[model samples]
Target: MDWTVKAGKLSPEKLRSLIFNRLHRRRSDILLRPGLGEDSAVIDFGDEVCVVSTDPITGASCRLGWLAVHVACNDVAANGAEPVGIQAALLLPEGVQDEFIGQLIDDMDAACAQLGIEILGGHTEVTTQVETPLVVITALGRAPRDRYVTSAGAQPGDIIYVTKGVGLEGTAVLASDHRETLLSLGVEEAVLQRAAGFFDRISVVPEALAAAEAGASAMHDITEGGFCGALWEVSAASGWGCEVMVEAVPVLPETKAICAALQLDPLALISSGSLLITAPPQVSIVEAVARVGAKAYPVGRVAAAAEPVLILPSGERRRLTMSVEDELWRFLAGK
Candidate 1:
């Protein structure tokens, strides 16, 4: 049979059969290669493990450089590693101005500086193949052999917690990149401006580290598929299921209003700033996240149901399966 894939991330089932299972490379030093929910690949170096992850900024038009750095770094952080360095790849369209590249580099440099990460090295070129500028970053970090965490470590009895509200990156991108379109949709200027500030909330290093310190079993950054997607990934990786309370998940007022105006589901939108954590029943992961100037809440519990399920406020249960496309992509395509 002839087959093709669509835009956005592939479904988890395809990832397992078509990609991960086919990797022939096997080395004892490779502590973790790749799996359904695992983000960074861990390479053992005796006492420490090097964690590496790569992500690209293809969806957001505003602050592409900054988003590229944080999104990739978040994966390393989620693995309980200290993000230390990054390498960027930039492809610019033909006839692009030098000043634009300079500004983009400046933005990347500034963002890396904020996180105490070094710009290792990368390649940049202006080419006719791209219609717009695209930035990809590979983030590197390190952790003690015993301290590193992965999404597959969660146990059945652990509690699932989420830090920060959902739809952060998507809300920011829609408000800033598609500002005029939102205005045409009758979204207030004040709402758009406030939502645009969500860019600053896209980093999850602090909360991830805090959760690790408090004895987290697993951690996943809520990214392209929002909170629900993250919950499903963590559950799938751990060979367990989750029961999430819909009302317990935090959804910001701006996110709700913006999503409503655009006819999108906030829970299905891309949310980069949020973090999903699973911890022992007695561990206070929420308190740990709060100490880092962010807040977390217990939204679900790990179970043996064999599939992740969402519990609505009305007591309805909805099983969640990985989707090929994110709501953010739909909105962007429509725009």
Candidate 2:
């Protein structure tokens, strides 16, 4: 019959052939287009370039509008652009109360206001086809054409840095959407509350722009595939290898508690607030990130094109294959 697929993102192979390859037409002004590791599209507009990215909110039940805005804008920021505005499409399941839409818009407004961006425009509707509310946002930003970064620009000897703790968004989703389940599993309400607060840290705009200005070689947002997936994408896109110290990857206490209670791999959990960056060893991205009130953790370095390996906490090496998948969907799917 026809092709069938899983619920999460399309695998890199299928995406390249079916999506990326299908776009045969090209424009000279479009410097950056879609690719395996690319999350945004860049269009040259004379002196400056516009970086636009589209993302949909699906995994989490709560904060749909907020997540939609931040997630889309996060992609633009990963390209080292200054986000200016967004256009959101809200698709809601039928039979929902009016209060629900109000809250969703309010959340979106709050997020946009915090980021100093506006909701330019979009469409919203209630439909029977959806079981839950879905928010899709298209965010746009601008930066000097010569200063923008890409996921495919990493080279050998570049230091790999991940900003903030991994599994941040996953921890928040579990805490907000599955609080009762976690409470029953002995997680304290305080921990859950803190986890929910992680929503505020969802945007990587400040640190990403800082890294770009610091001459970062490559940058990627840790989203669906978590840190593991982001690492694989950067390595694959850059056509290089990486050696990461597993112990050096930071995890919040609340994230650890939640993942442990749920038997989830924090490294493989969906982590949206984290940013993976690569830069020359001499560049001081640490200071640049710190200036933005964020910290950069050096967890690895880019190596020759061989294979990505993780030096486990126990000193044993494990290969990080392209097959790595996000853990959030597995739990949500009850698999």
Candidate 3:
């Protein structure tokens, strides 16, 4: 059978069969290898485990460079590593000016400065393969040997918590890219303005380290997938099912307004700023995140159910949507 795929990430099934199962190479020094929801590669570094993750900036156009840096770094941070450096590979479509590149570099530089990291080396070129500028960043981090957490660490009975609000990144993307459409759809300018400022809130490093310090079983940054996707991944990676309380998940008013105007479900949207953290019942981490100036609310728990569970806002118990596509791509595709 001949097959192909549309844009965005591949379904988890394909990832397991076509990708994960086919990797023939193995090494003892590789502490962590690829698996479902395992976003970073961990290599043994004698005293520390080197965590490396790469991410591409594909969805957002307004702050591509900033997203490129932070999103890449977030992957390592989710694994309880502190990112130290990055390398960028930029593929630019022809006709982009030097000023565009300058602005992009400036944005990336500012993000690096904030994180106290540096861009070591990378390649940049104008290519015919892409229609727009595409940035792929590889981030490197380190953690004490035996201290780094993996997606598979969570166990049944652990508490699942989410940091920050759902759909924060998607709200910022829409506010910046579809501002006029949003306004035409009755979204207030003030709402969009507030949402655009969400870019500054996208980094989850502070809370991630705090959760790790509090003995987190697993942590997954809510990226391309929103909170629901993250919850599913963390549970699946750990060989377990989950029960999520829909009403308990935080959704900011700005995000709610944006998603409402776009006729999208905030929970199904891509959210990069939030994180899904799992820990044993005894390890309360809300206070830990709060100490780092972040808010974390318990929204779910690891469960014995074979399939993912959801406690709806209407008080109905149901299965969560297993769709792999983010609402952002699902909505944009129909257009």
Candidate 4:
């Protein structure tokens, strides 16, 4: 069996037992706690609560340090909390250079500074157990006890919004890692540069803050599973169905071109910089995102139906699904 789940590949029950259920370790000393399925892990902290999350960069190592911080911080921000600190673990292959390590740390430090977050202590080592560099970041954030948004908060009539464009992170990674192939395929150097430049757009701080301020009921960062994955997560968590118009989801022209070149589905690619927000249909989510210099669009709405679905521009309705085999898999496999 594959280690990850993908669209049309795994039943919901199987995913619950294998992935979601194992994410938690039961403890008896916690109060005001929600289950493991929310965007962030909530823990009681007196008058306020802390939203914490940790994630590792496993697909690529070129910009491991920078991506580590932003990916983890994005999750914390999705809960409508400002990221305060991050703890990072750096694992490198035995032959890695000291200069490389220094450069990595420098980049991470600069990224943390830009986000106004502190670097709490973490472990670092070069070991034979790894063949490449790996970074894991744990982020800490606080929210007013009453204001935190969870995946479960979306209602039937809530509007579903996405920030920025789809496949931002995936495009960047592909451009960087497969430069030769892309250039040979007539991909313009400028287009490649723009795709690689997506690194700067990885943070979701602005969207999270704006949506929270605009009375968003729930927000989620679209990461490994891309837009399709995010929709599944949000709808599944909220116990509501969603109908997304295939044509309404935004994708950069370069992203679409790259997907066509690679014969991959942009909707199924990873998109860490994109944010999925759910709010009352009457709210001006587009204006809210614009206030932060981010683009937002309504791709769908929560439906009263019990199953998630997607409405294609061709007038076909199909079940919305996510897969663990992201675009990373195909890109890395040279498929």
Reference-based lDDT, each prediction: 0.89, 0.91, 0.89, 0.83
Using lDDT as the measure, the top candidate is: 2
Local lDDT at 26 for model 1: 96
Between prediction 3 and prediction 4, which has the larger TM-score?
A: 3
| Model 1 lDDT per residue over 170-264, tens place | 99999998888889889999999999999989999999988888899999999988887888888878899989999999999889988998999
lDDT of 2 by residue, 82-200 (tens): 99999988888888989998999999999999899999999988898899888889999999989999999999999999999999999999999999999999999999999999988
Cα error, candidate 1, residue 176 (Å) = 0.4
Greater lDDT among 3 and 4 belongs to: 3
- Candidate 1 lands at a TM-score of 0.97
lDDT score at residue 304, model 1, on the 0-100 scale: 79
| Native-to-model Cα distance after best TM-score fit, residue 167 in candidate 2, in Å | 0.4
The per-candidate count of clashes, in order, stands at: 0, 0, 0, 3
lDDT of 1: 0.89
Q: What tens-digit string does per-residue lDDT give for candidate 3 at 1-335?
A: 54778777888878888899999999999989998879999999999999999999888899889988999999999999999999999999999999999999999999999999999999999989999999999999989887898888988899989899989889999899989998999999999999999999999988998899889999999987687787777767788889888999999999999888778889878888899899999897999999999999998889876767889978888776555568888777876
**Candidates' TM-scores?**
0.97, 0.97, 0.97, 0.92
lDDT of 4: 0.83
The alpha-carbon lDDT assigned to residue 254 of candidate 1 equals 89
lDDT of 4 by residue, 22-46 (tens): 7676654243243423556877776
